[model samples]
Target: MMELFFKDFIMLWSTIDPVGTLALFTGLTARLSKSQKRKVALKATTYAFVILLSALVLGQIILKAMSIQLISLQLAGGIILFLFGLQMIFSDPEEGTGSREPGHQLAVFPLAVPSIASPGAIMAVIVLTDNNMKTFTQQAMTAGAMTSVLLITCGLMLIADRIFRVIGHNGSAIIIRVMGMILAALSVELVMTALGVQRWMS
Candidate 1:
């Protein structure tokens, strides 16, 4: 049981990538006041938690109804994640700030979606808690691990001001680009695994 918990925790942490989220949060909320940044952080974390929790609970049912195989979902998720990573790598910082409204839009979009909950994150939870493979207790444990990660993410966001101060805008941008490249590579691996390319080669 402890081993399972540890495995789930590591998988959740990697998929969620709290550090990467912090970098993106710092960049996105660079212009907002402390109080406003707090609100955005809380909202973004709440939204991400709700999204992932829902996926954990209802995802398998929906997939069964839709007749979607796990491999198919993985492939689709990898494509989405790869595109999002590309955007993160190439997007102009000024464009992110100028295009979106400060408060609500910032919380809901790039921050909450691809940045926090993320395609990879969503797929991960679904796969981790697969009804056929894991017992209810195991799934519940996975949920707990996911919630812990999100809470930590929120905590980091709340301190994003300090992080930004330490790293500065340029530093944060560089880290975000680096993370994006890593994400793109991970997505490609996910795609390959889903297609059984690795298995075939082995």
Candidate 2:
């Protein structure tokens, strides 16, 4: 059980990538006040948790019923993430993103979706909790690991402002653009990997 928990922990941590999420959060919420930042962080983590837990519980059934392949999600998420990355890179530094972005909407989007409950995270949870392949006990352990990682993600985000302060206002824009470039490349890689997997499977 300990081994299973550790294995799933490593997998979940990599897929969730709390540090990456925190970096993205810092970028997106750069203009927000401390309270607003906290709210966004908490909301994003909660939404991500719900999304991922659902994927763990009913993902296979939903996929089968809808005749949806995981590749579709990968493609969609990659495209959306790539578009957002472009926005981040080119967005005006003088404009106030936090004021324009609704609390819930911002929390639900780029933050909760691709950054936290990412295509990779969703796929990882579903695969780890597969009803056909994993026993109930193993699935439970995986769930525990998932919860642990998410909690850590939430904690990191709660302190994201301090992290942002280190970068300072002047550097925030630069970091956002740099992270955006990296994010764009990552999204492209995700799409390519999904296509590669499809070809390999075929």
Candidate 3:
């Protein structure tokens, strides 16, 4: 049971990469005051957690009812993730430049939806909960891992300002670019796997 949990945790962790998202969160909220930024991080993560958990519980059924194949869903998710990655890599961090005043509430959009409860993360949780794996405990473990990862991500975001001081904008940009490249490669792999082109090495 421990082994299973550990394996699932690692898999989820790699895909989620809370530490990596910390840099992006820091970049996104750089303009806000200390207290406002903290509020934003907390609200964002809370919303992200709720959405992700709901998706985990109902995503498969939703897909099935829509007559969607898992592979097709994966392919679509990969494309979305790839596009998001490109945005992270190329778009200016201050492009939107929200100046809605310091006390403005921030939650779902930039932080929760895309940053934490990302399309890639949603797809991954659904994929990992495949029934082929067996046992309700295993399924629950997958959910646990998802919860754990988002908590970690939220915790990191809470410390975004300090982290930004250390890594700076340029460093975050470089990391985002690297993550984008990795995500692109992974997206291509997802597409190939969906197309049933296994054993390409031969």
Candidate 4:
């Protein structure tokens, strides 16, 4: 249904945070040549896609093996995401300067791991596609939505240089802080939902 699709899309978008990824990508690859930036963008997006898709497919099995409950996972994920959002809001811009170093695998390090295919994103996909609750077709829909968001992320990265020029570093920093606030609010909502606060209110 349209409602389900919209929910999936919004959840994935918030977790993926493509604009945040773009800001980081611009910062990390700022010194690279245009061609090198393109390569980094492609590789980073590819790595992130693989990581997220794998989590979507295998997360439930792994959680079951560990005897983890969905509500527990959601609460834990919300806490992690909130902390990460806080870090993004307060992190120093110079912290990522080392990523510009020669021979550093920037794509896999900050870009792929916590930037794009972030812990929040991994948790979100698992929560979205809980095997006990969602049908296979519904899970497939969530996967599709995730893929769409990643594709958009890649597109943004490819155009990151131009966007950076338009926005400048200060603009990028402002955007990152704003996204962090949004992410923090969303994480709080996730926690509240996990606690059944909405159901109680209803």
TM per candidate comes to 0.80, 0.91, 0.73, 0.68
Task: Report the C-alpha lDDT of model 4 over 39-131, residue by residue, as the tens digit.
Answer: 888888889899888889998898789998757766876786688678768987447555454414778866786678876788889989888
Ranking of all predicted structures according to TM-score, beginning with the best and ending with the worst: 2, 1, 3, 4
Predictions in order: lDDT = 0.84, 0.86, 0.71, 0.79
Off by over 4 Å in 4: 68-104, 166-202
Model 1: which residue pairs collide? none
- Stretches off by above 4 angstroms in model 1 are 1-4, 96-100, 132-136, 200-202
Q: Return the top candidate by TM-score.
A: 2
**What TM-score does candidate 2 reach?**
0.91
Candidate 3 lDDT over residue span 35-78, tens digit each: 87888878877887887777777887798899987667657766
Which pairs of residues collide in candidate 2?
none
The digit string of per-residue lDDT tens for model 2 on 14-59 reads 9889999888788767777888888898899899999999999999
Model 3: residues >4 Å from true position, as ranges? 85-92, 99-110, 131-135, 167-202
State which candidate, 2 or 3, has the greater lDDT: 2
For model 1, how does the per-residue alpha-carbon lDDT over 54-151 read when each residue is reduced to its tens digit?
A: 98999889988999876786687678768877987998856645444457777987678867887778888999998888999999999989998999
User: lDDT of model 2 at residue 121?
Assistant: 91
Which number leads on lDDT? 2
